[model samples]
Target chain A: GGIITQTPKFLIGQEGQKLTLKCQQNFNHDTMYWYRQDSGKGLRLIYYSITENDLQKGDLSEGYDASREKKSSFSLTVTSAQKNEMAVFLCASSMDNTGQLYFGEGSKLTVL
Target chain B: SQWGEENLQALSIQEGEDVTMNCSYKTYTTVVQWYRQKSGKGPALIILIRSNEREKRSGRLRATLDTSSQSSSLSITGTLATDTAVYFCATDSNTGYQNFYFGKGTSLTVIP
Candidate 1:
């Protein structure tokens, strides 16, 4: 019955600006992931970490960076925002790579 | 290209009707997970069907997996308004790494 919390539910950034989103989970899971979802689209993986201080890139990781500083927290950074770029970023954790995942509410980003 | 891609089907049905959503994947996967996402929220796991299992059910929801076709389907019966949401199918490929890919999603609106 643990929860995943994501900070700054909504974000507005200017073009070329850098933005960071943070996530925390109390499930003591070993795998964490960050995904981006555009309107009317599916979730695209940006990055994932199997353990603390580990990082792996996904198909859509060109402009994003991720960090798993601790076992309970994972963060994502947008290197440079693009105008009219609006998407929802989700953070998820799993007990293991092949198990069910628990997700946070999400952080919505709007670039102006 | 995305590993798992939903049909992008948007379905509108009455409360008492039944609906089914489909997803297709391009690569080998060990498991397929169905998720439901309400507005302004992260996706929630509804069912997880493994490659070894063909069908799985939970209450009013049912999921079927076909490894030969590399596809899966989710069915909801006697839907309620609360069931209105976007549905996604995620594939977990134990490719010596954690590779979980999500489909685009199917948006379902249960009309009262």
Candidate 2:
């Protein structure tokens, strides 16, 4: 079975600081996505890439930037962290836009 | 409750009881997927039902969809303490690009 791995399971940042999270999937899926999950809230899409170097913005993409450096890797950057902002960032990959997705454990971010 | 209308819901039940969770969407979707997320983890797809199919079953989990009502329900029979988690319903919509949207989720606590 393939696994999706996310780096730095825990992250801490200050207000207005920039933070980056990385993800890698060995499933060789064509579509990759980044989602943010707040406490007791649903997963909101931040960005998605259908192929290498392709980026699509989702409803909550205002303060984030994403990069699909390759088919196996996708990264998300928080332009400016907000104080007291705590959330989990998830990385997922699917065979296509309309298929089952495999997700990583997640990267928890704490902004102080 | 409705994903497009309100916040997440919470449900508590005994371990051996049967429980059901409901979700409603506002837009047109080709598929509705049910995902389970444990504490400190990303969501994982448990059951999925397409728009054309009214019901789908997998092991102890069952999912039903109603296109006319834009709603879906997920039922788990004879639940166990391990089943305690947040359950989310996700929908795939085509808006120039295919995007998957997730509901706020139902936090289920299976008390043993």
Candidate 3:
């Protein structure tokens, strides 16, 4: 069994601040994704990486940047925070894009 | 418009009762996936139903898909307090292994 780990489980930021979230997985999966969920709302895909040095944009990728430095790690950066934005950022990994997904605990972001 | 956006809404249900969540996508999909998410946690895949299959089951969860209508439904039987969470329907387009697009998700609360 493998685990996907997300760093800094909780984040507190101000409006217009830049926040970075990190994710690491030991599954050695080729695909990784970043999604954001607001309270009582559905998740929106931000970015996905197929392999090392690869990146793909999803519907909500406009304000976020992602990097796949290596096969085991993927990172997401919120270019500018918005006030009253309290959402959870989730990291996921899968052997392939259409297979079952393994998710990290998630990083909660609170913008004041 | 890759996946029909109609299946992307949330739902609420009562405990000990049965509730069904439905989804519809615009594109041709070979596989359909169902996921559950609790408060403060990442989503977890519950069941995966394929194109040729009409129904799939796992414990108290049942999922049904109709290719002609481009629709899928998830039904939870004998709901419990632990079943209070959001359910997301994901579809993998016939394009193959490109990625999954998720719906808005249904939020169910099994009141005790």
Candidate 2 Cα RMSD after full superposition onto the native fold (Å): 1.9
TM-score on alpha carbons, each prediction? 0.96, 0.95, 0.90
Give candidate 3 misplaced runs (Cα > 4 Å).
A84-86, B2-14, B93-96
Ranking by lDDT: 1, 2, 3
All predictions: root-mean-square deviation over Cα?
A: 1.3, 1.9, 2.2
Give the DockQ-based CAPRI class for model 2: medium
Highest TM-score against the true fold, candidate: 1
Model 2 earns a TM-score of 0.95
List model 1 lDDT by residue over B20-110, tens digit each.
8999998888888999999888899999998999999999999999999999999999999999999999987556446678888999999
Candidate 2 chain B has its poorest 10 consecutive residues by lDDT at B1-10
Best by DockQ: 1
DockQ of each: 0.76, 0.68, 0.56
Task: Score residue A91 of candidate 3 by CA lDDT.
Answer: 95
Query: Model 2, B1-112: lDDT tens per residue?
Result: 2232224889999989999998889887788889999987788899989999999999999999999999999999999999999999988766632478888899999999
User: How would you encode candidate 1's per-residue C-alpha lDDT over A1-112 as one tens digit per residue?
Assistant: 9999998899999989999999999999999999998887888889999999999998789988899999999999999998655799999999965568788999999898
CAPRI-style quality class for the chain A–B interface of candidate 3: medium
Model 3 root-mean-square deviation: 2.2
Candidate 1 ranges with C-alpha deviation above 4 Å: B94-97
How far in Å is the alpha carbon of A75 misplaced in model 3? 0.6
Clashing pairs in 2: none
